[model samples]
Target: MKRTLVIGDIHGGLKGLQQVLKRAKISEKDKLIFVGDYVDGWSDNASTIDFLIKISEKNNCIFIRGNHDYLLHKYLTKNDTNPMWVNHGGASSIKSYEHISEEKKQRHILFLDHLKNYYIDSENRLFVHAGFTNQNGIGNEFNPDMVYWDRTLWEMVCVMDPSSSKNNELYPKRLKNYSEIFIGHTPTTRIGKSTPQNFANVWNVDTGAAFKGCISVMDIVTKDFWQSDPVWRLYPDEKGRN
Candidate 1:
């Protein structure tokens, strides 16, 4: 049966991405939703983007904009040389782009330019790079930056008791109208795990592929997931996000 595979932040781990897809045994009919951060950290940023673009041509793919992706797009289009972006893995992306053809670079820029901040599937699952603020529900206005950079949504879930009396006061106010929410920006590794985590109806799938962990992909419906080899192992010769 066809399934929706919501992928986590890739961070230029091409081999990791390939491995996860292979493990998932993805078919042409399956829908692929990438949470975000397709570039930076690893050495194969350009190749990773190329692979994603090529895969989109053959399968159902939805690319969501990540904070890294946004920074890269800004750099490409406006020559943004923000140190924070560069220090936080953007340099690797720049190096990768320098080796590619100008035409390909332009195409990549366009690809990044068109990324969506969030996506709501037919099942009402909200797929976003980070989190969105919604007091009332889905119809509430959201800040795009928050949608791609917020951590409070997950933070609240981590601290507040799911069974606490506060559940009614917090959940409805923080989460929008979505059955489930899948996000990537904050790696689960920070919490000392290299696997997807679940809390208060939110799933964090970024297993730190850009650093020492592996890339991850989750089945939106079944919640089953797959991972690649440790990301640093994929490129032993390079200092990945060290």
Candidate 2:
């Protein structure tokens, strides 16, 4: 079986991500899919983008756009002043590009623009940055907020919790299209601290790497999962040194 490796939010933790990939034993034949959030939170945003772009070019790698990625693209293109952007770990992303030339910045921006919102395979697995609404069908058109920051939808679908009120009736009716939906975005803590599960066939891989949690990678075919311990302190130096 062709192994499909789904990686969680990188959040610029290139070193940690490299170690995780090494541990996961990712091979050239394996299809690598990133759950997005490539920039911000960590010190190596520029290097992280460069690495992802190379992987995308060399092999079969799918990149999904996370909320942070959306914000970074906006900043790079329109130079928008979004305070929430900086608050949600965008400061580190800015710092990461401070030393880089304008040319490099443009390159990264272009790379982000090319990323897809989701990746669907023949095996009935849907790879998205966040997740689809269970109230709505998975075939529903992609909404930016739901695509980038829909934890409520994840909670509703992943846990099948009927207690929580549905905020947006605009969301999909249910997860009927795909057998499994992989997502990131909302921190796992917010998702209620627990390992990945198959509630309504929705799997959340965002182990909160940007906050106080691990970075996870799972092999879709083998169901093999690996994670790095919470490395929140890894960003204090800002020089990319451990």
Candidate 3:
């Protein structure tokens, strides 16, 4: 049977991504859901996006838009000169595109432009790069920034008791709409977890692939998972979160 695999923030750790995919035994038959952050950390932002574009053409794939991705989009489309973006690895992403052909750069911009904020699978599993805060549910009227940057949902999940009777009261109606939700903005390592971390009905899959952690891939149905070696090891000479 084919599996639905959800991967975490990539942060341009292309080699680490390869390792995790191999460890997960990924096949074309599998459906891959990437909780984004595809660019902006290691050195291969362009290559990482390129690989994702290629694989997406031949396999079942869902790419969620991440904050870094949105920043890049904003920069490309509006020439957004936010220093915050530049301070947080955006310069590295920009540097990655310096030598690429304009054609490929345009393709990457288009790819970013077309990315979805979230996806709901047949089983009602939510896949997003970050959390949504709209009390009305994941509708089109919601904030794009929230979809790619919110950490409150994860914070709620971390503190709420999943088995508690107050679960209903503790969760917003929008969040309650899914059986499970997968996200990848905040790294598990930020909370001292080096692997995919599960809290209540939310799963945080970003194991800090941009920094000292690794990439993670989880079987959406079974919850079984695979992880790559520490990504920093793969890029021994680069400073990641700059």
Candidate 4:
């Protein structure tokens, strides 16, 4: 059956990404939606981008922009190496590209430049790298940065009163905008979960592939999912974003 798969944050773990893809039995017939942060952790940053670019040629995919992707774009296209970024796996991303050809680097830049801020599928499922703050919904977002940086949406959902009806005035209007929301920026590992998690209608697929956890991909319709081995095991020698 045709399926729409929502992928979680990769964080340069090309091996883990591959594992999940294969384990999930993904095919060209299925639509793949990457939630983002494809770089800036493991040693495979450049390779990860190359793989994504190459795979996109044969598979239907939607690439959403994440905070790390935007940061890497700044460094690649503008030479901005913000210290905080360097501290947060940016150095690893830079190292990965050190041996790459300028031609490939340019291609990577193009890929990064075209990443979408968010995607709403035909079923009204919202897919974004992070959270959006506008209670009125993503279409009316007041700040563009909020789409890729806000954590309030996820935080709110995590603490929301699940029994409250959408019609309740005290309920969050943001959650009411879509049938379901898929995001990645906030890893479920942070909350002590090493698997895809759902709170209200928001599903956080980021299982912390940037850290010691694994990568995840979920069939949005059936809610069935697949995961890779812990990323730390895949790149045992590296600290990744730990």
RMSD of each: 1.7, 4.5, 1.7, 0.8
- In model 4, the worst 10-residue window by lDDT is 139-148
Better structure of 3 and 4 per TM-score: 4
Model 3 / residue 228 / CA error / Å: 0.9
Write candidate 3's Cα lDDT for 120-172 as tens digits: 88888889888977766666535666888898888877887667552557555
* Candidate 3 regions with alpha-carbon error over 4 angstroms: 140-142, 166-172
Candidate 2 wrongly placed segments (more than 4 Å): 134-139, 142-145, 158-173, 191-194, 236-242
Instruction: Report RMSD for candidate 2.
Output: 4.5
Each candidate's TM vs. the true structure?
Answer: 0.94, 0.86, 0.94, 0.98
Model 1 misplaced regions, further than 4 Å? 137-142, 164-167, 170-172
The residue-by-residue lDDT of candidate 4 on 143-192, one tens digit each, is 88678888888898889888878889888888899999999999898899
**Alpha carbon lDDT of each predicted model:** 0.87, 0.76, 0.87, 0.93
Relative to the true structure, candidate 1 reaches a TM of 0.94
For model 1 the local lDDT of residue 105 reads: 88
Where does the lowest 10-residue lDDT sum fall in candidate 2? 162-171
**TM-score winner among the candidates?**
4
